[model samples]
Target: MSLIQTDENIIAQMDSYMQRVSELAPQIYKRRPVACVNTFGCQQNVSDSEKIKGMLKKMGYTFTDEPIDADFVLFNTCAVRGHAEERVFGNIGTTKQLKRERKETVVAVCGCMAQQEHICDRIRKSYPYVDLVFGTHVTHRLPEFLYKRLTGSGRIFEISNDNNEIIEGMPLSRDGKIKGWLPIMYGCDNFCTYCIVPYVRGRERSRASADIIAEAKQMIADGFKEIMLLGQNVNSYGKGLDEDINFSKLLRKINALPGDFRIRFMTSHPKDCTRELIDTVAECEKVERHLHLPFQSGSNRILKQMNRRYTREDYLELISYAKKRIPEVSFTSDVIVGFPGETYEDFLETLDLVKQVGFASLFTFIYSKRNGTPAAQMPDPISREEKGKWFSELLKVQEQISRAKNADLVGREFTVLCDSTAGEGRLSGKTLSFAEIEFEGNENLIGKFLKVRIDKFTNLLQGSVIE
Candidate 1:
């Protein structure tokens, strides 16, 4: 697969279409056109929707939180789990009535779910009211697609295979002023049997280090206090790149930038996580003292079946090393409770690992089968009822650990970036360790960093802003 940069010609075509759409929008609407861009699944999809919104804003469209109030509605979808796809379909079904009530409403779907041929066929055969459908690779070309649909092009579906190109310089209509989502890379190389991300997102490709550094500098200058470097496997960054840099080196580069901002990343594969990365997290003052390493299963046999290249011992060793280097570091993780062949004995190992690590929290799920994946074809004798029981047990164990961990934090002080309002006369923010703490403060504290003392623990950490 050859790496292709989006050429100037395509960019010019998109610009022309953008201008046409902007000119045509006023003629079609009596008032300002409003769009509802609904996002599903991961942070990557959220980032994609922000870019779509940016393009829509340029084309003279404002936004709405309700689809019923929208002249145009776009579903930025996810295909990670069957439930997410079902939710998207249910929401789309509701929009059919809206389309009927307003004949001119432009309804569209895009992102990972739209990349699948089966999903596209279903939408075509059943959902005739939908105007356009595009895929993960052509997000930068949304203006062109929207223009065609507006000009009476019937039901545009553009789910082409992976184009192996990284398009740069798309405008972003970010959701917040304080936290910025910066995608350092795109796609996945690991084909874990339980995941459809690699199939939907395509092969791994890293953005140029210079481009990333430029974006980071711009975000800091824009007054973004937190920068989240996003990817399927962030540790796999710099692969297939010309630079000698890797994820750890990249972190150090961003940490060196002059700012009071904090850096965080996610969904790290244990196989690609290195000692250098852990040490860099320990050493960098600007980087958050939190690591979200996902150890999906604890059984070596089940892990091998899942095609997660690392073993339980390997994961434990990394945790041990991380603890030795950064004693106060907090960890969050993802765990699957019931695999196709997982036994109660295998699950005990998972419980053991969880107890050993003492994680801050866990994102736990029972394995969901995906079509066109290797795991789906495997023989299974276990029942969903049994899986449900196992899932409950895992949740119980994790909850206890989490409460104990939070209780230990009582009386400790932390510098938190207040990001949102929790309730009346309350503000919520995250500590450098990525802990959510709600405190008594005014709304003016929303974008500022302040010292807070933890006085209690309940569902979340409760604190008071230091005077």
Candidate 2:
């Protein structure tokens, strides 16, 4: 394994950059500066973006929604799939003219895409005008990266080749004033053959539980009401540490925190979804009654091929156990259709499992090949047309499930946490079950909760807010 996949080495880099980053802060504030961040990929990336924004703000830069008006444009990119890569490349190309127009403008690229050797190679060769590059691990070092860009000394600042470690004290600008993403852990230890996370994010290293609680406490003090605990694999949190704390224990600890905030986590592997964890989830009042368990494929054969480390029966049992323990508990899942060698019957099995489980919502994707994954080299690949057809079929069934689930909320009341801006005339938010709710309210309702009654819904969504 690469040294970048470990923890000890990363802590050293943190101290190095923290000292340098602070020294560079005053320089950025001296100039008339503006920054724009274009993000792609997961909640982890969103959390990274929040920190990036926080870092830039500390350096006295304002944000702009338009790239053309900005003095500094940063592409917080993703390489999770081919389509995401294409979008970033397009954005970079389009931004090139803006850089040429304003020769002093700092153009940089960062995120998981920066971790890949090939992706970095292309950026260096074809996009030399790009002043700075960094990765997931180097988000805290972003201030330093930008510092270099502001001066004439700009070059690629990607420190992604080093080992992974938890960088405490990184500030964040929460997207929602009332909600925040708290990372319990970072990176992945599971090298699922189709995944580039372990390669790009490097290995699993957990933050100290004490630090996590301190952050949560601070957020609570700041009056935040909802916190989503983010991780590539949340269940694997604390297992990599010396303290021997498990995820369930962490959840229970947070639930017992001196606050009324709701707690949520994501992307659990079925192999690690133990009865204890399920029971703990059922018992914790603060823990939301929703779980985002990603079943990449339904067929045991295909699962084995993806190196999922669990059989189909194992997943079904876990689902059954979780539902039994918390009947009111709803589920959302990640499913990939048309994986390599995935027969029609295999696809049907996934459909069957989805219906059997009756997920509150499902995030479905067509199997897009990733360059460095083992599944990428496999023979008998699913064709684009076949993948498209399968995706459509999967969407049809999922839409039905979603509609039925939303319908069940009729005449029922739910507590929704409002985060986004109100639309033309109504407020938009998410319920505890992660259901989308749009209700009428004043602008002041944007960062608070409302007891909402399901008033009506279209074929796609629900309408709400208590009388």
Top candidate, metric TM-score: 1
Point out the worst 10-residue segment of candidate 2 by lDDT: 1-10
Error of 1 at 127 (Å): 0.5
Taking all chains together, each candidate's TM-score versus the true structure is 0.98, 0.92
Model 1 earns a TM-score of 0.98
lDDT of 1 by residue, 1-467 (tens): 33637577777788788899999877887777889999999999998888899889988899999999998999999998999899999999999999999988999999999999999999999999989999998888899888888888888999886587888776678898999899989999899999999998999999988989999999999999999999999999998887788999999999999988999997699999899999999999988989999999889999999999999999999999999997589999999878888999999999999999999999998889999889999887789899899889989999999999999999999999999998889999998988899999989888898999999998889999995
Q: Quick one: how many clashes does candidate 2 have?
A: 1
Q: Which residue pairs show backbone clashes in model 2?
A: 4-163
> In angstroms, how far off is 194's CA in candidate 1?
0.6
Q: Give the count of colliding residue pairs in each prediction.
A: 0, 1
At residue 50, give the lDDT of candidate 2: 90
Encode model 2's per-residue lDDT on 295-392: one tens digit a residue: 88878889989999998888889989988898578899999888889988899889888888889888888887899999899885568898889889
Candidate 1 lowest-lDDT run of ten? 1-10
Q: Which whole-number lDDT from 0 to 100 does residue 28 have in model 2?
A: 52
